[model samples]
Target: MSAARSSGTTRVVILGGAAMGSFCAMSLRDQGFTGPITVVERDPSYARASTALSAAGIRTQFDTPLLVEMSLFGADYLRQTGEIMAFREEGYLVLADAGRAEHRARLAEMQTATGAEVALLDRAELSRRFPHLNTGDLACGTLGTRNEGWFDAWSMLTQARARAREAGVDYLTGEVTGLEAQAGAVTGVVLKDGTTLPCDWCVLAAGAHSAPLVAGLGIELPVVAKKRTAFAFRAPVDPAGLPLTCDVSGFWLRPEGQGFIGGIQPPPERDDHPPEDLEPDHDLLLDLFWPNLAHRVPAMEELRLDRTWAGHYEMNMLDQNAVIGPHDRFGNLVFCTGFSGHGVQHAPAAGRGVAEWIRHGAYRSLDLGPLGWARVRDGQPLSEGMVF
Candidate 1:
């Protein structure tokens, strides 16, 4: 049985139901678009999903102005949904190395220029703010004085999907086998169950699984699944006021429901993975993470080790950034893949921008044309620094 195809109805089928896909559906309905939106998700447990397995944290202090703007917009949306999301303003603290003084100065300048309420603090100020922190070998840090925190990422994702459903977004559970196209435009998607869902617009929000699905249509996307491993530890003492702290070396820690969670990017060679591999690299945590944290905060030596897990980030090879908006060859097909690791925090604004692009053919809030596939095709890189 082949998937059914249609043209009259403005049906929109999204490929994934993680944070980005669900957020796009929610934003479309919020903006009063009455078109039919359908979401397809294969994983019922969502255990291996990035949204669920991430070290749930959010921050607005970024080096790139566009990235900071996107984060601020996302933070604002989270605040507005406090009643629905049960969002807590837990705040975030970013620690830097003294050797990266130039980068620190640049980030401060960018934050101020973008009007982010981020503060640059010296080691003394950091110690004053976080009295428990050991600033023995520190330089400076950037703190999101307000509007930075972590929420139940699972809760946030479920809420967005639920709200989208309430707003008439249909959801299907299956793997995308292929896409149906005509005249270089997407018409519908074929699921593993042989069900064809017709749509006027299609978004490739399938996260790590996007590559194979889109590849079936002969559209070579650069998004590759890169594994990120994280570990959770029970704090020996009450780490209540512990802001989500990210070290200059890319290691980050924050509070989960009952314990403190942390992770660092694996060395570049160790980051690549095959599509089906979901197991975490626990050896990296034992070898690298422990030594790094022990060197920075000796008190962490008392923390009891919790279980570790891994998730995939759909990394774009071109610039190691996101490939947003539509593809050049197929205007009707929208894509928001290759977010590297920042997809969770950037979901809100990216969702809104994608929704507007579908409705108005342009994003009125912020022009995401810079992230379009045209740049990749043209061999240009709008490289934004401070990527973790």
Candidate 2:
């Protein structure tokens, strides 16, 4: 845990030290990156982070094996939460509408391939398993039997930051205004104050802000700020045994302390926004989310609405999947943004995979080639059916 800078040492500068950045920094230390690491974060409060604003849920009930596999690894990390970050396990459930029988079957097939403990429950079984739930409209549901659920995202991320600091990661409060490049190699970064910190490599993990940041270096990333809203409800029924459930319709809810918190994707036009400070419209819950929730679960009619908040999804225009690995053209700059809504859940594995790619020049653990920059250029649509 030494910051002793030596001549010709590989200094790595990371952008945005919230969940993704902090996890990336922790991964670097865990992978034995001994060079000076400086994490520049614009908002240390992390109030607007997708990590904090997320439903804080985890699940392996995804369509793609990579995603399910990544969450499986993430679940293990969450299981060892006490040793790594120390948090409680709440759990997650994915509800499927009668129309989504095909999608449910496909997901179950993928989960089985990965050996994930995702149980495909019929309407009767789902109603019995989750007695509090009104599964009248549900044809089936995929429940994470054991190691799947929601957690204290803020506490987990904060603990990752603490561990990264313990491992010699410097957390600097500043906005990265510019990058220092020499002959197609990243030399350092320029802060808002015009002070330049030289580095051998740079990681653009700036979430929504990453688009403009990378564009500054002539790298045109299609990452846009897609507005998403989240609302909490203090339901009449106890949410104790309830798992974090997402209606196949994309509206999701999970138990948070005494109440349950959740949200749905906004309509198309309302989804895209400029990268700026915008507030959450709680009416999206009543106008959009509630109607759908009621349709999915009849008992949601009795659920009382509580406090709500909103955040931006660093949505990728081309495909909803994340953009990992280095910029194909800019060899020195690594791009780890555009995870859309799945960033928080996939942060641990994504962070470690990118860190490994950075240190070893290839992904030694999980081959994240599906999320590579080549797909963006080749116009390949990823086979991600469940994008919410």
Candidate 3:
């Protein structure tokens, strides 16, 4: 596959080489962009990359139509994971209690309108479909019957990186320390080792560290790092046929290998800002997660904790959704950060959209207008209720 010739100079410098960066590079190549694409990554091992540490669930059960549409594309993209990475269609079940029944129904209407394969299941239907679950306190549930599940995100990222490299994309190991901007347009990026890489276009995809990087350019993105922990446990009974179930209490669990992996959303008032460390929070698991699991699944009452790990969500505090597209001021600098945990699933579509924008000066495939930074600048945040 030969790279497409660009109309003008298009030397792109991506600040992160994880899932989003690699996928963006692949998308550019796939879209016939023959520009020099350089991806700068500090950690090539991806030991702490959010894509490698994510729960890796993909679904179309979003409250907004745009999100549903993006995730639907993501699910279809993951269907080809057999050639790129490992994937499984175990399905996802989102439970809604009486308090959120109306909201859940509204979301279901929107999801169905967007061509999502989601069904609103009553309590009896939920129990019939998932007998292992305890749906006694639920009013209704939204179940993704098809094109939804989990996959090995690390494998996908690695495969994408390898493909991008094979396609002539340069993968450089360095940390971007500064950006050189002239007359509101980025001109070059400076590495920590005092090396300058001049770029015609710059992309900020540094995950949780993107906020500080953009701040250096006088952009105020309301993105912060929020820590989320996933606990692995072994239940007394087999969790076969069990879908990734998210209870009304914001705690979610799913079958992983011979056991299960799960986590819970922290309370709204709780400060989730933690140090840049991936230390598992044992207290959160033993205190909050276990109790919720026991209440939702009685078999989990006798479950034993196997292990635990943590990661950061590049949370968009402005709206809990993604902030994509080019910057309002710097047209040459693209904004691909602030996914707030949806980066892994939406990377394929986002990368394609960004590549299209760079190639044709517009989003030719998926309409990502709703996720632009203009809304953030205007104080008009798009409401995305499904933030777990």
Candidate 4:
């Protein structure tokens, strides 16, 4: 912990210069850390980065209180600095069927308790609010009236990376091969070119590739890559009153200018897509999402499918929750990955939290202890109630 206080001389290295790594670098600087910082990313173009391929949705409708808090904080941070990210505050609406109505209503109450502006509506009210939606099968619905929407995720990442570099954080383009550790501290980072960069502190934010990077160190991180497909389409439904709506039929949709976008996580049996395979599966859009869209919003029955894309979600196998804070085995190595699909939305808060941990040896603003490495080490899963 003594090393945390010596901010002026602490050398830090971050892996994967995407959303998480870039945010952490900027936040570290924001926290008054004058230490030398370097962010190494394999792809400087970020063409295939998860941050660039996401559906770009943000929401504070989760059932977990801490996650809800993170969402609120991230939303505020984005609005404050998202002039170029196309920040949208349209909000998120989740529909519940008869069986899950009471449970979902309970979640809405919890979200409201956590200062999330949300409202619970019954079937009639849901129909009144979204007149085009086929609410005959819905028992109730929850709507986040504020701080819940989508934005351009790639823009956010790019801005953070640029800001970090402008603040004197070095942006290194390299393929990290492994970590060099001695005793309990990470001594250096080994690159694919056999170049080793010495560092006093290391942050692992490699997203889906995080597990493989640390596996040789005898650390088994449950973070893995899961393929998610999204489609953009023009529909008869009105985009004016629509929110990023999640239906009971296991699909979510939202407005994007002249058209709407929607997608779903593939079934577990077929979700084992190779991390390198990014081919869009149009069959799922036709067979799965279209039917769900037609069932939820009758207006979308005539929707015309357009361009589609596929990406990987850094899914935590043990629990769909993020793991942050100091690594148990290597004290100098802080983890800021394993956010499942919520990485893009939670990056701001989580990155700030990481900076706090590195600068003060404790979280100053938000207590992210509940999502620390101890749980992952002890096999205690802090699972979220549900994921979107």
Which one wins on lDDT?
4
> Model 3, 1-388: lDDT tens per residue?
1122364356999999998899889998998888899999999998888898999998888776888888888888888667554567777899988998888888888888898888899999988887777888999989888878888898889888998999999999999997998887888999999999998888889888888887888888898888888999899868777789888878989889999999987666654556486677678876789888888888789888888898888899888898888887788888888899877989998888888888778899888989998999999989777877
lDDT of 1 at 270: 79
Candidate 2 lDDT over residue span 241-333, tens digit each: 677777766788877779878888877866655677558876687787888777766667777767767877888888777888777666767
lDDT of 4 at 337: 94
Off by over 4 Å in 2: 1-8, 83-90
How big is the positional error of residue 236 in model 2, measured in Å on the Cα after superposition?
1.2
RMSD, every candidate, angstroms: 3.2, 3.2, 2.7, 1.3
lDDT values of the candidates? 0.79, 0.78, 0.85, 0.88
- Which candidate has the highest TM-score of all? 4
Order of candidate numbers by TM-score, starting with the best: 4, 3, 1, 2
Which ten-residue region of model 2 has the weakest summed lDDT? Answer: 1-10
Our tally of clashes for model 4 stands at: 0
lDDT, model 1 = 0.79
lDDT of 4 by residue, 46-87 (tens): 888889988888888886799999999988988898578787
Model 3 ranges off by over 4 Å: 1-9
Local distance difference test, candidate 3: 0.85
Candidate 1 clashes between residue pairs 3 or more apart in a chain or in different chains: 3-196
